[model samples]
Every structure is written in C-alpha cells, then in structure tokens.
Target: MTTPRRAPRRAPAALLGGATALALALAGCSTPSSGGSAAGDGTVTITVGDRPSADQAAARAIYDRRVQEFQKANPGIRIEPSETVWDVQTFQANVAGGTLPDVLKVPFTEIQALIARKQVADITDQLKEVGLADRLNPQTVKIVQGRDGRTYGVPVLPYAIGLFYNRALFEKAGLDPAKPPRTWAEVRAAAKAVAEKTGQAGYAQMATENTGGWMLTAQSYSMGGSIESEDGAKATFDDAAMRNALTLLKGMRWEDDSMGTNFLYNMNDIAKDFAAGKIGMFLSVPSAAYQAVVINFDMPKKDVGLTAVPTGPGNDNKVLSGGSVEIVNPKASEAEKSAALKWIAFFDLGKYINQEAAVADAKASAQDGGAVGIPRLSPISPEGFERYKEWIAEYVNVPLENFTGYTDNLATVQLKTEPVKSAQEVYAVLDTVLQKVLTDKGADVDALLREAVATVDTKLARAPR
Candidate 1:
C-alpha cells in the first residue's frame, strides 16, 4: 500500500453553494409549534432519528430486526426510524420546533445544548429503576449527566482512537512487526526509520484547517495537557504540557520528516494509505481496523495491526472517544418515553444483535485478510472473544488490552458546550503556532503559544451559548 501523494480535489463551487443552500433550507424548516398533548397509549407511534454512518446501515438492519421482535412480543407498538444529517445546529432547530423524533440519537457533546434549551427528558431515575446505570462505563455516564446531576441518555456504543500500522512497512524497515512504539520518542524513531528505508511517508497526522487543532488537542491530552481549566471557564493552552506536545508534533514535521509535507491527510486518507501499504503508521479510530481488513477482496491478510495511541513522556494515556447518545424528547408522552427507554436498553443488551454486527464488521476486514477491533461489549461472549483473538493474532503482536486508557470526558464535554462562533479562527491560530515552531527552528514556543491562547480565549468568550 502507498499513500496518495496528490491532494484531494476541492468540491465544485456550484456544488458547495448548493449544499450550503440546502442546509439553510433545512434550518429554515424548523419552527416551533404550540404545546401538544402528552399521552402515550398503545396506538401511539414513536419516531426516532439518527445520523447515518458506514456501519449504521447494518446497525439499522439489526435494529429493525430487534424492533420486529419487540413488536411481536407486544402487539400494537410501532417504531418509526428516520435518518438525519449529522449537524448539531440543524438537530437543535428541529428540537426547538417540537419537530424532533420522540427519541433522537445525538452526539454526547450536544446533550448540554439540549439540556440548556429544555428539549430533552431527565432519565436519571429511569436508568436506576431499570438497573442499567451500573452497566455503563462511568466515564461515558458522566458525559450524559446534566449539571444538576440528572441523567438524560444512554450511549449505545463507544469508540476510541489508536495507532493503525502496516505490518509490511514495519518489516521492510527492519522494525519488529510485533513490537509497536509505546512512547512519543519510539513513535518518532520508528516512523523516521520506516520513511527513510521505505521511501514513503512513515506517519501522517491531521494538520489541515480545523482538524489540525483537533489532532493537537488529542496529542495534548495524551501528554496530560488540558485546553481549559477543570471548570472549563479558563483557558490553559499556554500551559507547559500543551507546549511540549506541540513542540513534539512540530519536531515530527521538521526533524524526523516522518509526517507528510502537507497536513491534509486526515484519518480517512491515512486509513486508505495504510490499507494500500503506502503509509507505515497513523492515528485513527478503532473502526479503521475494520476498513483496512476489508480493503480488497483478494488482498492478502498480513497487512494491518491495531494498538492504543502511543504514550507520551509523562505516562499520560488517553484517547478521544466519539459516538452518539440516545435521548428522548421532552415533548414525548410518558408512554412514548418509556418505550424509547425500553428500545435503548434493548439495543444496549442485544448481545445477539451486537455480536452479529461485530462479526460482520470483522468479516468485512477478514475478506482482505486484515483484522478489526471488537466492541467492549462483544468481549462478554466467549465465542466472540475467541474469534476476535484469532483474527487479531494474524497481524498485531502486542496485547490490545495493554494500550487502553481513560477517555477524556472533560475535554469532550468542554468542546461540546464551549462558546465558539469561529472554529476557523481558533484552528488558524493554533496551526500558525505549530507551523512556526516546526518550520522556523526553536521559534520562541512560549510566545507562539500565548498568542494562540489569547486568540482562542477571545473567541470562546464571544461564542453563542
């Protein structure tokens, strides 16, 4: 596999304009209505909305299958599933207008916004009564709780970022395919060696536009850095820990030359290149393992491996978790809300549904003789774990359990609610700071960071709540 050296072409201007217009039109479609009756009898129809994903098509099939099972068990109950675009503002607009589905799938970050607008129901007691509260990951549960300590939703699945490596490249560089780097130093060293020996980019980090800052945030958190204070009311981008993280990334571009010269190669391109055997290693969600494993029907399977994101000098182990939560609308009737909760619980505990989905995801990768990561829940099945272990043993040398870390709940929550009208401005300042450090050589890291921090602080202060 080789990295696609050419930059991705931009979307046509007319297409871009049309997309903007469509988004605006959808936004305009949201308009509030007078309060309606809240009665949920057997005839009540429950509407649910969720954003589409690559796996969602299959997940939806599984969900519908379960719905059929549920309906068979309880006659007269109907579940209607709707698809929505993945945009917070548009979703909020629907919520404000009372046009939202009775139950909606939302990113954990958006829960705060929903809470602030009184758009979602408080499920704290419901969860306790159902005995599902104790089953959730505590870190995930924290993200769904309101400031007042009431639970609002349940997470169906959780995803964390990690390192995706190409075994062929590692072997070519005389590095052990079984042993991946654990610290930032090892990552740089191994990547540099691979780049030099293989004559291909060793690693690629997302440094283009707003994503550059997002990648930096992940790296910073892994180094025990925080972008804001504990309460999220204060900025801390200028702190030594963050500066150190930035310094290390800048060093990668300048000293090691392991990263691509251009920063536009995001997670998608990185996965594609790794699958094509063009790139050595990169940061990506665990799901990338599935993509790589399924890249080509005839491709040999000894190409990909998965491990936790490399550790930093201070032993900080963390990764950004991205997934959606299922929230019931406040306007939903008691019976509708109860039905929604039951559906959520059903999906969460549907071991057959989950296991089948996991197997399908893994088999998709296995077609290329590549491996995929198992969901935390799927490990509960003895047969599932045995199959997962066999698939993983084909490529990865290190134990997957050794690389896991605490998800950054604080950062996830802050980014969700942080007032920032200009995502571009915030990203630009941080990118400039990093570029200067990497290109100019020992370029007053402190001053660069302070300027970036000030810019972000101002933007944060002015963003709409």
Candidate 2:
C-alpha cells in the first residue's frame, strides 16, 4: 500500500547493449495451481508492474484508484502491484530473482526476442475473448506478433522519432523556434548558427551504447536508407544515403564545430545536457525528453520544442516508430494470465474507449503536473484516438503547440519499424561508428560503414529465423 519514489524516466533502457533473452518476458516461475476463469474458488490474483512509484504522487493516486475500480468491476480478480518498471539492464535479474511482474510493459524492441524465447504468453485467445482482437491497431499488431502468427503482446504507446530542440536556444541563435529545420541541410545551417551565435553545442548526438545505432537508424530512415536489407539477413548501410547522413554529422562536428564537447553521450547524457540548455537540437520523441528536462534536469517546460525528424532529400519524410507493449508472463498460471490481461485492458485500453475514464485520467495527470496532450503516435485507430481526445479536451495541460513542427507532418509522414534482426547488436556496433565519425577528423564514411556491415552481418547471421 506504500508507494516508492519515482526514478527519473527510464528511456535509457533503449541503450542497453544486449537482448534479455527469456528474462525479459518472465512473469514468475512455473504455472500456478489456479487456472483462468476456472479457478475452483472463482478468484484470480495477478501482479502488475509500473505502479508510478512514490515520485509521482498524483499519478500514483490515480493508478491506485483505477486498481480499486477495476477490482470492483471484476469481483473475481485480486491484484498485487509493484513499482518495478521494464528496464533492459534489470530484466534478466528480475527474472532470475523470480520478481518479474505477471503483467508488465515492454518496448517493441523485445517482442521478437520474447517470442523466440517463448517468455510471454500467446494472448490471441484472450484478445478474442475480450473483444480487443478487432479493436487493436493494425500497423502496431505486426510488431506484437510472433513468426508463428500468435500474438505475444498488446501495443499501447507508439511514438515517432522527432527532432528535440531547445526553443530558447533557437531564439537566442536568431532562428525561429517555431519553424524547426525541415531538412538535413537546414539542420546543418541551424547548428552552425547556434554554435557561432550562442556559443553552445548547436547540435548533439547520443554517440555511446545502442543509442548511437538507434539514432543512426532514425537518421537513415529520415534519409531514405536502412541499416539492414529487406530480408533482414544482411547489413545494408554501405550506401549513399547512409554515407550522406554520417557525412553531415562529420561536417557539423569538424567543419562547423557545432556538436558539443561530449562525444560519448548515451540517452541519459544527451538528455541531461539537452535539458540543461547546453545543446541546441537533437533527435528524440517528446515524452522521454520532456520527462528528463522538466522532471529530471529541471528545465522549464516551454524550452522543450519538438519537430519531426528532418527529411532526407529524396525521402518522403519517414520517421521511425517506437513504443512499449503490454505482455503477460509465460510462466504465469492460467488464472494469473487472464487476470493480467484484464488489468492491461482496464488500465491502458480503457482510457481510450471510455469517455469518463479518459476525462478522469487526463484530469489526474494534469493535477499531477504531468504533461498531457503532447501529441504522440498511438496504438489505436486515428478515429478512436480522436474520440478519446474529445473526452480529455478540457484537461489538456501540456502546451501541445510547442510540438507543432512535429505533429504537422503526422498525417503525411510515413512510419517505419525497427530492423527485424540483431537491432541491439547492430546499434551497439553503430555506436562506435558514430563515435569515430564525430570525434575523428579523418573518419572515413565508406570504411566505417564497411566495417559496420561486416560486424552487423555476423550478428544478423546468428539471429533466430
């Protein structure tokens, strides 16, 4: 019944170097004696994760209320909750310690691996049972399924890669903060101006760990390139588009001296610096960056301006899509699994489909001083989300307009998925490539890409078919 303090947002989980294997999907050890809907006593107990911790008092209050409300509606289910959140580094340990929450959220990056390890339950039947099989978003469901066509998780929060910029820096550099860079060329120009005029790192990059590769992938997608070929069996970054992307970074760092002194920033490093106004423009989605800025780094909320990923010359403005999925633990008892599904349904999906719930949740978030109405890519149909918006209209608190540049392209921009194989490994290797290119004046784009291709191909060959 007591809440723990919230840690600063855990977006750095993206930069973790290795796959968590079976651990990432584990809810606990072995199936329980109790079974779903068929428990002899007709009662089910389940453990859920991401309980807001003590750090978010208002959000925690709302979460607790929702749990009570859910139990009231589903009289047969009893819930045990934890503040345990999904973090890649602790994943294996959590599983080893037999503490993995029965129903927890995980990122899209782990879906394929979870399915391969059979760590998560196949929730296809449950989806059908709950009527969510049809209501789920089609595009995201692809990311939630296994190679055998079974559903492993339910996609909840999907986001597109966007350019995160310091609006105050833009104004100081004599640039229009409202009009962010529309193309890579514009980004280069803006970096130069911010560097010379403001004497700050006009641009920054997450050059360490998997983030280097992650950001590179986003850049490649923006520039109409991909790190892997369509078959997902080989490396494919040794081309002009990718080469051009790195070349731009090189120019900004060496020619313009626009990038900051730090060449080893991961998500955490970049976020702290970006939030402190030491950097101008970088790439990230809004939520994580905003959390770090306003909540962690203590930056003013208005300073965080976001825009869509700057486009490559020939690409039609494609941005990488990402989000977490709600997956049930494979080891859970049938009853526990069923209870977990219901928890997910009521906790996440309920807000989207139910008018009063949406309004109430939004109001609670606003009261918690949480950012609301920050536009994001959703896992529901556009129409469904629009209707949900109507319910929360009055409680909208986040200055959504700060993200006009990012949201303006939502209707027209294309959404791209992560590479199918060895994404973490590929990104880890790419990290070195970004570091070398950004820090080494003579860094050869062709040679670096060639070396990366060889490394990535070796890793991809080990990927599960």
Candidate 3:
C-alpha cells in the first residue's frame, strides 16, 4: 500500500538554516537562558528542542498533545517547546553562546565530544532516581556515557547499519529473497548472479564525500576492522580487516563487474537509484533508506528487504550503529535538570515501559503514514523491546517479515558507534581512499590505506585533548 510520507522522527538538520542559525546563536538572539527559570510558586520551566514544525501537522499535533499531557501529569513543570535542532554548523556556536535549550536531541557521535567539553549535563543520579538506569540497554546506553562511566543522555532510537536489498530484483535474478548474503563470498556470488541475470548493478558502494568514508568504516567493521583506536589516539584501519574488505570491493568492481558504472554515489543518489531498481543491494540504515525508497521514490513497500550486515573473514557479529540522544543542558539548574529528565522519560522513552504510550505512538505514526515497527536496535533491553513490539503489534504498518533477516539476528549483533575523535576529518580522509580504490582498477589498496592512516593520525594528534 502506498502511504503518504511523514517528517522524520528525528527532524533533519535543515529545519534551521545553518549560516543563519550560527549567526543567531553567536549573536545570542532568541537565546533562552541555559538554566531554566524557576517561578516563586515552585514551577520549573524548561525549554525543549525538536518541536515539530507546523508544516508537519500530524507530528506536531502529537508533540503538542504530549506536552499538554506531560504538563498535566507534572503540574509543577512547564515546557517551552522550540523547533531548534542539532545542526553541525550551529552546535558549537550555540554551546559557546549559551543559546541551547534545557533539553535537546543530539546524535550519538557528538555525545563524546559534548561530554569532554562539559557541554552536556551528567544525569547518572537523575536516571537512577527515576529508575530508568537499570531498564536501559547496557550496550546501547554506552554511546551516551562518559569515560568516567557517568550517563549524560537518554538514547531514544538506536539503529544498526544493514544491507538493503530489492526483493523484486532478487526474484528477477533467481536469488532467494528470504536468504540474503551472510558472508562476503556469498555477496560476491550473489552480485555476480544478479548482474549477469538482470543487467543492473548487482551491488553498489557509496563513494562520494563523507558517505564514502562512512560506508567504508561500516564495511570494515562488518569485516572486523576498526577505523580508530578505543581512546581515539590512533588510526587503526591499516590492518588485515580493512585490506580484505577493500580487496573484495576491488575484485567486485574489476573482475565481477557487478558494481554499476557510477562510482560517485552519496546517500541520496544510492537510495534513489536503488529505489528505481537500478541497483540490487547496498549498505545503509534500513529505516532511513526505507523512507527514501518507499516514501520519496515511490517504490513498492513489498520490494524492499533489509538484513544484517554480511559477516566476513573476521566472522564477528560487530556492525556500526548510530542514533539520537536526548541530553540536558550542562548549565541547567538542578530543578531544570529534574524537569527535563522527567520530560525526556515521558515524551521520548515512555513507550518501552508504558503500554498506553507504545500503542499511542504507533497509532499516531501509522495514522501519519509513517513506517511503524521497522526493525532497529532498541535503546531499551531485549525484554522491554519485545514487550513494546507486542504492545504495538496491532498498529505496525511495515511488513515484519521483510525485516526478519535483521530482527531475528539482533541477539548476535554487537553495535559499535562511529569514531569519537576527529571523526569527520577521519571520514574525509577515508573518503579519498575509498574513491581511489573504487574508481581506479590499478589503485594500490595498501598504499592508499597507508596514506589515509598518516592523514588521520595527523588529524587525531591535532584534535582537542
């Protein structure tokens, strides 16, 4: 069934223009006090970010209703909602100028830096007081914890990078739609078969800008390689895992000729083409790519298939993961912090424990024509997630069977976050290395990797301590 598209759950960064936002933040214009004010009558007022814009009527309606409900439940707390979202260009400016909301949503990648810079509040005590600490998924919550083991944010929606394939294309190529490739060897064979049979790009890799590096890191992790060391002190991609991954891609491009002629695919380009049935399989976040394909490009819902990242020589269950975190302002007053955490727990995390919330959110999303119950790595424990699924089963709109390859394998998956130090710089360097290997048949993988290592090491060295 064709469904109308809804605004992404985590609003895109484009809601506020970058340059304009940076200027406004730096100028302290429209800046709310970092520490929310307390009224004489004991009302704790906290401003929250990511309030859906009016254009997204359904989402905004749900958000507004939730705000009203939260306020009604907690009579001593009041919410002042804002449309401000996390934009890379404005994030630093906002932090420096103290223009941030008491509660805001940020990506997992930024949590480490925010923690190091003391720009986010430590909520270890708060989480415990609310009895949320023990209920959280230990692995998923690690992304928002500091080296000191203090929790700084609440993980909302965690997801692992997976392989997105076209079931229709698989059928056309005489491959099993239910059993996607689980190993590199199988991927190569499947790509060859799909290419030979359907004359389309059997498999494609993103090779443009940061996405090139992002996918390269994901591929390396799937093969048991890491891009940076644990402490972020050194580059670690110059190992056997990385070499093996590149070698496989080189062979696919040069020998199997399964990859399409295009070697400059970004996230959008790859998703567009994949939806058009020009490509068979590629790596991406299933839900994100699903929206691009089924919503924006009008691909049939039954045609999309999402599965875990195929294992390789490393044979480990490791895969890359990223998600959004709801963090309290570092400068928020104790009262504000308490209020903000309560709101986050109610508005963002109540679904895992509250059946009413789980069903309400699912029904609202489904009514808005949003994909509900797409497979994902949950922020809550396995038991909690299962219960949540059961609670919302009646409202789920996405085809559950199409996601079994991902959902059924969650027990064995180990999620790793993006590189912590100089992540963007590291991605930029790897982007060059990935593009060189994909576009040039004679490219020397070792030499390219060595150069990338040197560049990333330099970046890591110059990074803030």
Candidate 4:
C-alpha cells in the first residue's frame, strides 16, 4: 500500500531573511536568569532543542506525562518546557541572548563546537551528585566529555547506525527477511539481488553535502576506520581502512547503481523514501525506524526489519552511537542549576519517564508495523519491556537482545584528545578530500590523502596546547 505524503512545510521567506536581524538584536542581551530556588517554590524552566520527528508527538507526550509526575512529586517545583527547532545558528543566538535553556539538548556531533566556544556548562559535579557519572551509557558519555576530562552533558537517549530493510522487498527478491546482512559483502550481494529481481533501488546511501559527510562517517566506521586519529589532532581519511570504506560507498553509487545520483536528499528524505518502500534497504539511525512508521505511514509492519550495521572486511562489527546530551548552562543560578540537575537526575534515575518514552516510541512505530529500536537502554522490568514489546512483536520484528554491547565499549573510547588546535580546520580539509575521492573516482586518492595530512599537520603545529 502506498503511503500518503504530507505537504512539505515551508518556512516564511521573511522569517528566514530576518534570522540575521534577530541574531544581531539578541547578541548583546544578558543571559536569562536561571529560575532561582523559590525557597522550594520557584519553577525550573528547561529549554530543549530537537530535530522535528514523526515520533516527536509520542516523545513529547511521554515528556509531559513525566513532567507532571515530577511536579506532583515535588509540589514546590514547576517545570516549564520549551521546544526549539535544532539549528546551530539560532541556538548560538539564543546562547548570546542569555535566553538559552537552563538544560538543553543538542546533537552529539555539534557539542565539540559548543565546547570550543565555552558555551555549554560543565556538570561533572552534578553528575557525581546524581550518581550518574558511572550509570550513563559509556558511549554517550564519550560524546559529551571534552578533552579536559570534564563532562558537559547528561545523555537522555542514545542512538546507533543500523541497517533498515523492507521485508516485502526482501521476500519478493527471494531473500530471507529474518536474516539481514551482517557484513558489507552480504549487503552488497543482497542489494544487487533486490535491485535485479525487484526492479527497485536497492539502497539509498547518502552522498550529499547537506548531510555534511555523516553517511561517510558511518560507512567509514563500519570498516573500522577513524575519521580522526585517537588524539583528534589529524585526519585519518587517507588511511587504508578509510580508503576501502570510501571505495565501497563510491562503488555503490557509481558502479552498483544502487544509490541515486542526487546526493542532496538529507537523511530525513532518505528515511521517508525508504519508508515508502521506494528503496529496499539503507543505513540509518534507530530513531529513523520510528519516523518511517509514523511519518510515512505507508509501509506495512510485515514489510519492515532492523539489524545492526553490517561489518566490512578487516572491520569488527561497530556502529557509531549518535544522540544528544543534556547540559546545564554554566551561567544559570544556583537554584536553576539545582533544578536543572534535579531534572537530569530524574531522567537518569526515574524508571517511569525513561521507560514510558521508550514504550511510546515503540508503540508509535508499531502503529505502522515497524519496530521501535531503543538505543543504549533496554527495559529493566518485564512490565516496561512488555509495554513496547507487544507492538514490536506484532509489527517491526527484531530481536531485543543486547545491541548496547556494541556501543558500550566504544562509547567511552575517546576518538580524539582535547585542546587540539585547528580541529575544525583539520576536519574541513579531511571532509573535502574524502568528498573528492567519493564523488570523483578518477581523482588521485594518494594525492588527496597527502594534501589532507599536510593541511592537518600544519593546523596541529599552529594550535595552542
């Protein structure tokens, strides 16, 4: 059955144009007063930012329910929640205006930039107070912890890259729906079969700039390649493992004819198309499963499947963990800080809120016959697991066996050392070189690698310790 498409929401041209004006106007403003303790009466406001998602409604419902519960538990504390669209530029403005939320959520990838600017608050002590320093998913902790050995945020949820497949297409192609690919060779073979037999695009690997080389990172890491060395001082894109990874992606796009030529489709578009069954299988985050189920609502449950990311030759099975961490603003008042930390602690320790959110996400996906894959945390109790398991079993069928193991070892694994000068510049050069290699097969890979290495080395030399 074909899913009905919703009309795309378009931003007002005037509003888009006025962003700079708004930013300038807010630039000089003092930071918002973190709601001080009302001697146990003041409200604590948490401003959260997120990418809009189909599962967001359910997630928000879960948030509201939990907040209400928390309010009841602490009658003197009022929780004010505000949602903002995830945009770095706008978030920076909010930061400048001192209107930044006391506790805010941001993408894991962007946290480095925020840390560089000293915009995010460090909450190592708060974490210790909440006894969450060790409780948090180690992989999640790694993403938010700076080179200074100080952690800046508390992770609410964690996500990992994985293969999402259309079961109907798999069956039609005479492939086993239950056994998804576990390695790159298997994936390639399966995609070829699906495309040749089913006459549909086998995969939708992202090759676009708008995604900012994220898909490349996924593919590269799947091959056990590091984007930057362990110290984060240099680009490793020219390394042997990375070359192989990039070559595989390039082969898919240029030789295999599995991917579309236009790389402009952002990750969301890719997920939407996959949900519509236009594509057979694709690499995506666990959260995309929720989106495919609710937003597209086209593909039936019997047709969807989820699996851990496929491995490559010379690569161990590893999936990059991606998600945000909640950070309390440093400038917030003691009361506000206390309240924010309290909320973070609640999220970490409160059984009801975390389980409810996961269950809601799972149910939403199940509504469309898709499986909900909660990253990092599994349901601790039978009741909590059952709440979502019924939907998962009925629609999106996947084993709930421990996938967190794959991320746990890597989560606390530092990819780079902190205070790396020219970190951004090194990344930029590396991305540019990798793009050239991926899109232009005829390009000299060795030359590009050498150039990237030189550029990174120069930056490292110039960076202050």
Scored by TM-score, the top model is 3
Instruction: Please give each candidate's TM-score.
Output: 0.71, 0.78, 0.86, 0.66
* Candidate scoring better on lDDT of 1 and 2: 2
Top model by lDDT, which number? Answer: 3
Instruction: For candidate 3, write residues 1-465 as lDDT tens digits.
Output: 000111255322211122122222223111122344877666788899999899988767667766776766676787999998887567778878988988988877778888988989998987876667887888788788899989999988677888988899899999999999888789899898899999999999987757778888888888888988887889999998899989999999999999988999988889999989999999988777887888778888899898889888785648898878899999888778877877777766776667665665676667666677878788888888889899889978777788788888886678888887777788888888888888898999999999889989998998765
Query: Candidate 2: misplaced stretches above 4 Å?
Result: 1-37, 44-69, 78-104, 113-125, 145-151, 229-232, 314-317, 328-340, 462-465
TM-score preference between candidates 1 and 3, better one: 3
Give the Cα error of residue 192 in candidate 4, in Å.
Answer: 2.5
Per-residue lDDT tens digits for candidate 4, residues 302-347, read: 5667676777865343466555567777676655665666666554
Tell me how far the alpha carbon of residue 360 in candidate 1 is from the true structure, in angstroms, after superposition.
8.4
Q: After superposition on all CA atoms, what RMSD does each candidate show versus the true structure?
A: 9.9, 7.7, 7.2, 9.7
Q: Which candidate would rank higher by TM-score, 2 or 3?
A: 3
Q: Can you write out model 2's per-residue Cα lDDT over 1-465, one digit (the tens) per residue?
A: 000111343322111110111112221322233665345766777888888879887667656766666666666777787898877558667777877888888877667777876778898887776667877777788788888898989998777778999999999999998889999999999999999999999999887767888888899888888777755788998877789889999999999999979999877778889888899988876666676667777888788888989987554446887777899878776667666766776776776765655665576666656666777776776678778788788977666888888877775567777776667788899899999998789998999899889988998897765
Q: List pairs with backbone clashes in candidate 3.
A: none
Instruction: Assess candidate 1 and give its TM-score to the true structure.
Output: 0.71
Task: Score residue 182 of candidate 1 by CA lDDT.
Answer: 66
lDDT of 1 by residue, 25-81 (tens): 223221122223322442446776762445755555544555565554434446676
